[model samples]
Target chain A: MSWQLTEQDLPDLARGAAVLGTGGGGDPYVGQLLARQAIREHGPITVLDPDELDDDTLVIPTAQMGAPTVVHEKLPRGSEPVDALRALEKHLGRAADATMPIECGGINSMIPLVVAARTRLPVVDADGMGRAFPELQMETFGVYGVPGSPMAIAGERGETTVIDTGADNKHMEWLARGVTVRLGGVAHIAEYAMTGAQVKRTAVPRTLTLALTIGRAIRQARERNADPIAALAEALSHTLYAHLRVLFRGKISDVERRTEAGFARGRATAQSFDGQHELELRFQNENLVALVDGTVRCVVPDLVCVLESEQAEPITTETLRYGQRVTVVGISTPALMRTPEALAVFGPAAFGLPYTFTPVEEAAVGTTA
Target chain B: MSWQLTEQDLPDLARGAAVLGTGGGGDPYVGQLLARQAIREHGPITVLDPDELDDDTLVIPTAQMGAPTVVHEKLPRGSEPVDALRALEKHLGRAADATMPIECGGINSMIPLVVAARTRLPVVDADGMGRAFPELQMETFGVYGVPGSPMAIAGERGETTVIDTGADNKHMEWLARGVTVRLGGVAHIAEYAMTGAQVKRTAVPRTLTLALTIGRAIRQARERNADPIAALAEALSHTLYAHLRVLFRGKISDVERRTEAGFARGRATAQSFDGQHELELRFQNENLVALVDGTVRCVVPDLVCVLESEQAEPITTETLRYGQRVTVVGISTPALMRTPEALAVFGPAAFGLPYTFTPVEEAAVGTTA
Candidate 1:
């Protein structure tokens, strides 16, 4: 499908991306503003399905890396995303034909849109990760044998670095992370550049439209005075994200947060409204696990989203504060994420959790409207 | 003066460089061996006076970054220096017609020679710093006018990173240091690239021949069974390094070491052979300061050299050990480094020393022979 993203779509895209961000892509406010401003200035953006691109067309993924605490306060100069793309293009001595998101969650998802709007380049419908993960190498692109560089990391502070190394994808993540830290713990990186056919073969397909639909569903539910949670389940169920369930419903009783190694990390404890049960959430940028009363209720590769209990507004992990009323939703990740190979890189073990992963669908039933 | 460096020059060059290294720049043994091997295979290297170059010719400086312990143990793949130069060339889209040293001290001084041997590009007689100062921004080039990047840093693991930023020279050093740490605590950096005219105006003139001459003086002193310490002071007094003195003479009694921020850091205490006095030496990569019973003696912007008491071999801080007899010599820094402005950056205050700087010559009487 080919689509044009006008300013009107910004709210829904940011909302859905926040939900998909599963608490780690960082706050979408800045990303949303940047995208809106760019679109308003440069006209609507043409978003293309990966297949719409010719085999030789070049596509690059754009992302902002840093602790959410830092990115939230130190807004980008807005030129960063495009600057990173141009740097990558210069490094290649070839121009990128389109832009794509490295992940479908948080601020990262919106970055590509901003670049596409400003450059009037087509934006790819797919992303490297169907949902957000904490680090660069956790994407399906790496698990499937694609190298991350020639990647470019450009900072708002007039620093542009290009790395073409024989290092493995994980090492590439470390190298990029180090550079981000030096650039005031925030930088725009355009990496994992691939040809259009490689994008089709490796990227998680159509997450952009899925995010828009998910955003629209919850908004429509609020308008109709229906259950937003049920609307969320149906919205996810209709897409490749085929399983959804509310893993916990509670009021946040306690929360701990620490910004470390360019990540917003901590645990959140939500107490049951009935005072009989509690949910414990562990996160490193994104929520990795949810345990209810010492029982493992959800684990990755599965999407764990925290939403305000009544408003159903997506509460990213960075925004999780004490005394908030919330419901945690679990959606089975895209099939590409559940493969044994992909699981090896992003499963519970990869996050240093004790238990192995279990599909959210297998762990719960009757989760749809 | 234009000259060709035969393989026989490697020993004296390494010897003088180690002395100038002033207990930093790591062991030149490996660098010397590498240069010897390259010269044997690629034949003689042309060494050029900065004035000999056409005004538009490109000149790049090459050096290794990181702790001596790690570099000595891991060793480079031998291609890193050339690889870094080539990467810089590719980044600039202009081939380098000549190469130079960022610092004419320790292992860094030997890098340009090795590169020159391999590429047959003339090695410039001038260097960024007449002596090493442990950081990149401390170069004379940046203080005068030229920007550091279009600088390229290449790793032995086949990684080449180019950093192009409008950041100040100090920030460039920090950024490059950060990258070096990620590339396994050691990397080859080709930075402060400039045109031949810029090199002639900013570089410390004839520092290469100075290193070789100094090396030959100490070696000849040992061969003649004369006082090597006196010979060293005489050799330095005869050149632009117009002042020299023995700051302390003793046997190593105690040493402390720790690796921090990818730099070998520690203090060594040398107790006088007669047992009345002791000198405390502190270093980060190279010797930064020396104190006699808590009184400041030699601070940065001046050269501090540690030599084996018997053989006159330059004992770099990395190889400092208990029970070795040694003489600590101090030489007035090049006139460029002693300026109030330059000292403000590489001075005693810059390195966190408590007192104002006093030139070794001004502080010691009858210092020159």
Candidate 2:
């Protein structure tokens, strides 16, 4: 399937991507603006389905890397992603026939759209991580043994570094993260360059359109005065994500959050509006685990999304504030993420939770909001 | 003015380079061992005078960047410098005609030797910094107009990064430093690629031979039971460093050092044996300022070297310990470093000291150890 994305679609797409961002990736507003500006100047971008890619097609994945706190303050110069892509192409001696989002969350999801618009390069409707993970190595591409170099990192003011640290993705992330802090807290990073064959094998397909659909569902439900949370759940059920549940409807009770190690981490507690059960959210850049009344309700690789109670707008971790009425929703992650191999990388153990992860379907089987 | 460096010279050269290293650049023992191993396998490395270069020769300066703590733990695989050099050559579409040390201190001074031995390429007898400075932009090459990229950095395990940050040396340092930490705390870096014309224009010429002379003087004085300080001063006078004086002779009473921002930085205080006076040495990678009883003594770009009183063995900042008897020597920096432009980058004020820098010749004229 091929779809053309218009400037009008950016808002819905960004909103839904933020919901999927799970708390990190910075706000998608700047990314939306950049994408719209590029599309306005370069015309609408054609979004290609992963199956549309010829096996020989070269695909490059790109996203911003750094502290979300920094990326929000210092928006990119818009040319950084393009600069990084060109640098990679020059190194590889072949042009990237198509571009893909490294992750389908927050600013990163929209950034590939910006690049696709500017370059007139069609974007594949897929992503490495079906949802954003704090570190680059936590992606499905890495889970499938894709190397993270010769990756290129581009600074806002023409600083570009292309590195190949062999198969060591953790080292690449460490190096890239440090450089991102030095490059004014955020930098555009393009890596995991793979052929179309590898793309089909490693990528979580249909994530772009999935993000748009998720966004449109919430938006339409709000306009029609329907239950947006239920709408969002229904929308996700039709996609690669099936298990969905509203874990809590509450007003904030207590919040503990600290931004460190290039990530915003800590826990948020939401007591029910009835002053009963409370949901505890533990996050590292994103909400990783959620517990209700000391029972593990949802864990990593199972989507734990927070949203405004009334408008249903997604609330990223950075914007989680005190006393706001919100709803916590849980969705099952993609099939690729459920594997023990993938779990080993982005699983609950990776985040140092006391209890191991249980599938959202199994955990939320009989639970009700 | 040209010489061949054999394995026999590694000890004296490493010692002398460590003295010039000020307090950072890591211990040169590992560098010397690697250089010696490369030379033992590939024969000797020929040293070329800067004046011997053809106008069209391509000269690339190589060094190591990271925390000394990390570097001390993770040793290089000996081939990283060569890999970085080859990567740079491939990027530039031209082979490096010759190599040079970016700084004539610690591991940096010996790394080019390793590369020269392996590649059988002659090393230019000059360096960018007459001594080490923590940041890349503090070098004379950058203080003049040479760009710091298209530079290359290589990891010990077949990882390589080539960048063209486009003449912004500070950003280059930030980007490189960030990557270095992720590269297991140490990475071989080759930067400031310049033409022979630019090299002659910006490099502190003959610093390699100067290191050899300084090394030979201290070693011979030790063998004959002569005053190595006086011999070192005499040898310095025979070169561009005419002003040399022993500033202090004391036992280190207090040493406050911390590794921060990828640099080993802190201050060391030495109290005189007779309790007559005390000297304070403040450093950022290299000793930047020396104060005698709250009066500014010698400031960068003047060399402030700490040495063992009995053996004249250089004591790097990481090795500075409490209650060790040591002598401090002050030597004038290169003429290139004395210019207003260069001084603007390395003077006392640049290091956040109270007063402007006074030349070592004027400051130490009437003072005696």
Candidate 3:
């Protein structure tokens, strides 16, 4: 169903998108501010149901590309996403019928809403990745044969680059990452331009609504003084991410994080209150794998998310620090993201993890309840 | 006036371009081979005098961008320059009326000829830089208010990127350089699209003819058993680069060069045959400064060219090695290139050298005869 996303919706969207980010995709708070400011200036944006989109509707997905740590400090000018959309429109020689999120996670989810608000184009209720992955080519749209170019990238200073490397999505990612680094470690990009029919077939549908639901559930649970993590799990049970489990409830003991090559890459270790068990989380922008006592319990395209222990607020990878009480949660990814072709693009092996693909549900079986 | 650049002319062009390259631009022999193959397959190209161009003529300059060392080993597929031109033309929405060299030095001088031969577009006899400089924004075209983008870069794999970063040439260069590195250390680019009037007003004119003259003089001098160095100096006397002086005649005793950040950069030291003086040449892709016995003898916006002591063959920075008999030559840059405006972009200080902008002639005035 079509809906309108006003300034009031940004908080829930950002919070939910943070959960979907799996500990990357940039800070949701910053995204919320940018989106709220954009909506205040340009009015609420219409959110179009992907199913209702005409087959020929030109849909372009917008996102921010860079290290979350950098984005946190170097806030965008708030016009980069729209500037990128306009540049892409100029390159494609067509006006976009609607805009969408390439990744329905963190700042990326908010970026398309900003574009839609500024352009008065509806945003499709769908995204290429139901949850975020660091690289551009990890999108379900790319896996299903959508070219990542002619992609447009815009910097804070109104500089724009249009990349049209034919059919090599990985090459596009490599080139775009390099450009992002040159643009002060952050850039807004509009890419994977697709028709509505392609979006309907390949995109993870209703991810925006799913994020809103998760965010709303967490808020309501906190308001009622109930367990927010349980509410978050209850919210996911009704969505494509049908399985959610707390892999570890502990205080962060160590975080070996560094920003390198435009990514916030590192591993964090958490120790249980009893000091008897340990959990390690590895991430490159987004959390990629989780190991409980050296046994793999979660691997991407599954989601390994770290949340505040009581309030269930998502903690981005960049914000992970020593001595934080947190709950590490693992949620099964959408079935569409676990297919062999999709897994080949973003599986544990793709991230150099020497492990076979296993659902978070299966990996979590017989672990701590 | 216009002239046909046949396959027979390529040797002279490459040789002259090597001298003009000022020790960078990629190896001239590789460029000669690429141009020769293109001409043999497609036909000779027309070299149009810049003055003959109509005001409305849309001209684009083409060149290779990367470390000369990389180009030597990973020879282009010979279609990259043309691919870049076509991509730029598509972006600009106008077919090019002519093509030109962005730099009339090194392999870049031959790159435009390749594009022209394949596309059947006349190659302009003028170039942005009469002699090579390492960075893109160092061009006279840019210094004199020409934008370097709406540019196109193409990889050997037929991948292409179009950068249209409004009026920020340095930003354009930064983005393009990053893209070049990601494209495996070498790329072909078409940039600085200008009108014929802009070309006639800003470009260093008749550089192709000058390269040809230098090449012919050296070749004929060798044939007649004459001193090629003296012949080379005689050749420069008639061109825009009217002052040429041999700074040092020595054996290369020490060389420190490495390919880094998509550029061939380092220093080479040559000791005089008498062992009384030392000449140090510092280069980044192209030679930028020459210091003789700790005194500045040359600085860029001028040419510091290294040549074989006897044969007078230009030796690129990448080929500098220990124990090679060589002569270092310093030639004055064009008057247009030494203006206060031009110096601000490519002067010694721009390269982090602590020196004032002194012409090569003035710097060499008190040196040994």
Local distance difference test values of all predictions, in order: 0.85, 0.85, 0.91
The interface root-mean-square deviations, each candidate in sequence, come to 1.1, 1.5, 0.9
Q: Enumerate residue pairs that collide in model 2.
A: none
Off by over 4 Å in 3: none
DockQ of each: 0.80, 0.77, 0.88
Cα shift from native, residue A252, model 2 (Å) = 1.8
Question: Which of the numbered candidates is closest to the native, going by highest TM-score?
Answer: 3
Which candidate would rank higher by lDDT, 2 or 3?
3
Show where candidate 2 strays beyond 4 Å: B69-74
Measured as a fraction from 0 to 1, the native contacts recovered by model 1 come to: 0.98
lDDT of 3 by residue, B1-369 (tens): 998999999899899999999999888899899899999999999999999999999999999998888988998867889999999999999999999999989998898988998889999999998888878888889988989989999998888898878888888888999999999999999999999999989999999999999999999999999999899899889888999977888999998989888888899898898999998888999988889999998889789989998889999998888999998889998889888898888888789889898888889977763
Error of 3 at A41 (Å): 1.6
Write one digit per residue (lDDT tens) for candidate 2, span A245-296: 8788898777787757777778889888778787889988888988888777
User: Docking category for candidate 3?
Assistant: high
